[model samples]
Target: MHQPGTVSSSLHEHVQIGDTLLISAPAGMFTLDTTRTNPVAFIAGGIGLTPLLSMLQTVVKQQPERSAQLVYAVRDHHFHAFAEELQQLAAQNPAISHTIFYENGTEEDIEQKHCDYVGRITEAWLQQHIPADAEVYVCGPRPFMQAMISILLRKGITMENIHYEVFGPALAFSVD
Candidate 1:
């Protein structure tokens, strides 16, 4: 997890090879419509990458005709997980596109092509990069998801076409 909390951190610190951890089946409302052939765009922030990445992989493997776009934001390289796997997927699949944003990117990171953009994601950047007609799935911190949803709505994307999962308490937004 990118932003580990008390439970996750404790598990990481204390779990052993033979640890019998109780896990439940995955559940969430933010689901991908694999049956649709529309282009898929994923907007992820920090630890939110996990679910979105799974969807991306499924799309790549099961629906080769569908195009996928990933816009990932993280604190920096250290927090950027699945870097190699992402690169490999994009490299092997011409229909897949990956863009990464680093909040604390160094000059070397950009010069060496480690990140696509520096600084936090913005509404303008999202509008310019992500296709408005694409089916969008977003997962991120509460505030990030809120802002992304608001922006997508304002960009003329119907609420039904945008799906998101927030990490914290549920937040309500005023849809125009």
Candidate 2:
């Protein structure tokens, strides 16, 4: 996505509102099981926060008691995407919460106050925040997701408890 000549790059920089676009029917290998009431953790990085937003909204309306948490990683407070909508969703749904991790972030500030984090998320951080038994869904840049998957494995979370979506031709998963 950082590559300038790629499709993602062009879309991110050049797409305009009201512009007609063609798309295919929705498809993905992973989806949230709405009937499940177990604790859940969603880990996303940068623009990777896209997919989980809709799922969280559904939880807010239909399963207010389903415990859920979103941990998003970004370059900094100013660059964090979806902060407002996610925060609003969390506020409206008692069972939903969100945390933001800023890799090149400042000390606790107005931006950090809302999302509850201002630094890189480490294994220790995950241990303290994410429940050991919760189902975790991760979507992010390839390397970040890979690192978090490794951490989840090291923490004894089984493969069945982890869910990730493959984006395009790459093996995609979530974590920042």
Candidate 3:
């Protein structure tokens, strides 16, 4: 059965990014918790912003009494997805804070007055952006997610508070 507000086509919709179009958004297990009031942190990279958008919208609608920090990583500003929407959300929600990191930019550029963070989301970066006891969610490419998980483990972050979602095919190990 097709659910209201959701497309019920076997074919995926093409989400355009600049001049590029890619299939996306069929169905997913993750959903927003409109009732959560804890300090929350989100780490996103590339096109991983889709699911985060849903959660952010839900939070805005529900108006949960919680502080949120979103750390988004991208190659550069041009390829950064949903930049304007994120900016708008941050402006609208007083409880939300944002930090953007461009891996292609130098440290000085990122540390400049208007910029957020520079380089990739390293252990030090995570430590600086996320609170020690905050509820953390990570969504990105497999390598990025793995790196974040490693950093969290090193920082002694509990598994219960850390969540992650991956897009695309699951990596498999094969013996030669």
Candidate 4:
């Protein structure tokens, strides 16, 4: 989380190398279905890149023939997570197409080859780049996810084809 809470802060500050923290088993419907071979587009905002990155890496290793596009949006070049891992995965897999968006990036970010784009991902850009038939997976803050869902809907993407997950309380599916 951007601002760690008490528990998270304690873990970060004092957890030892051999710490055995007990946790509940992972449970979520937001998992990727590796059975389908359709093209996939992953849209992430800030730290939301975590889950999508796992799925992207899986596709690269298991479904080598599958086409995958990762559109990652962060506050700036500094906030971009998994840069090296992403680059290595993309370099090894020709089917993986990755684009990083730096909302607060500058010419230096682009000049330094830190980001491919320097703004939020928009409807126009998605339409021009992502295939309509591609299965889309989105993970981000509530507002970012809402905007992405709205844009995907407006772009004629069915709800069944668009998948997303957000932290904290559940979000109502209403989109304006």
Candidate 5:
């Protein structure tokens, strides 16, 4: 769960096993581009994985030929949600590759969590993992998205190939 003030936490705490709840429909311009066939690279942090997971699931069902990789970063091993399902999906599907990173994890933690990498996700690490020319989709904290975007730009990834979405409250910073 995220925390007290976050959407994920609120839903987790209030929602019951058999309870029915009403919610607004999903509405967001940030979404996967199904037309692109060049391969997809999903970089998600914390709860941002939700939307990307949906996209990945769609890719598996609708376009199984598409090659996709997911790089996920979470606070720790125990805190990662839907981990077992993600790992199993990756293991069973040849078209998908999944890697998990823990920001505050030890080697033991990595082993226990069944995650691939430790520490925070880095641009260099991403470069080595994702396929070249893969279309990138990033969603995470503001600092993470900003950092990843900067690194991606430095690596010569065109603006057209990179997409992003922000969750929670936005930070105040002048674009100019």
Candidate 6:
């Protein structure tokens, strides 16, 4: 668990260890809730997809029946890390659905059919994709997370159902 108000840059450090990049134990507030069988939705942006990947791995190993929908947003396909792996996971797990939203991509560039949505995800996009009563987990840049949270609130999602994880130092965004 991350200490509230104590921002650390080392928490986001990535190192190459031989053939693999050694990622630290996902240090964030958001964790997969195995107890709940309700529909779960994950909103991740850029490198914020790390913890969500861990959650998905854990889910595949421990609780495979949990229904999940992951909406990942990135700048482009080349910048989208772990694309192949996520697609494979989604295909193997019947209960899991994954979608990618690329800021600079077309429908033909993506691997999965109807799984790619262009541009940033809005409240209307979320309302169309996610169920009315689903547990939503969001992790990304401060602006992206804030926007998603605002949309969720406007859609009448309870505060308890909306969880968030911030990576690295806290970002100070000017809302004005």
Q: Clashing residue pairs, candidate 2?
A: 138-173, 138-174, 139-174
Candidate 6 wrongly placed segments (more than 4 Å): 1-28, 110-115, 169-176
lDDT of 3 by residue, 83-121 (tens): 788888888889887888888866666655234766787
Question: What digit string (tens of lDDT, one per residue) describes model 6 on residues 32-120?
Answer: 78788888888898878888888877777787888888889988877897887898999899999898888887777655443377777
Instruction: List TM-scores for all candidates, in order.
Output: 0.84, 0.80, 0.72, 0.86, 0.79, 0.76
TM-score of 4: 0.86
lDDT of 4 by residue, 48-95 (tens): 999999999889988999999999999996788999999999999899
Candidate 5 local lDDT, 120-156, one digit each (tens) = 8887896677666888888877777777767776677
lDDT (CA) per prediction: 0.86, 0.78, 0.71, 0.87, 0.78, 0.78
Candidate 4 pairs with clashing backbones: none
Q: Least accurate stretch of 10 residues (summed lDDT) in model 2? A: 167-176
lDDT by residue (tens digit), candidate 2, 1-176:
35632786788788999888887544355688887888988989777788877777777787789899998988876777877898789788778888887787666653548445666789998888888888888887767778878888778888788887645554435443
Backbone clash total for model 2 is 3
Give the clashing residue pairs of candidate 3, or none: none
Cα-based RMSD of the predictions, in order? Answer: 3.5, 4.1, 8.3, 3.2, 4.5, 6.7
Q: How close is candidate 2 to the true structure, as a TM-score?
A: 0.80
Better of 1 and 4 by TM-score: 4
Query: How do these models rank on TM-score, best leading?
Result: 4, 1, 2, 5, 6, 3
- Scored by lDDT, the top model is 4
Error of 2 at 63 (Å): 1.2
Comparing 5 with 6 on lDDT, the higher-scoring candidate is: 5
Residue 49 error for model 2, in Å? 0.5
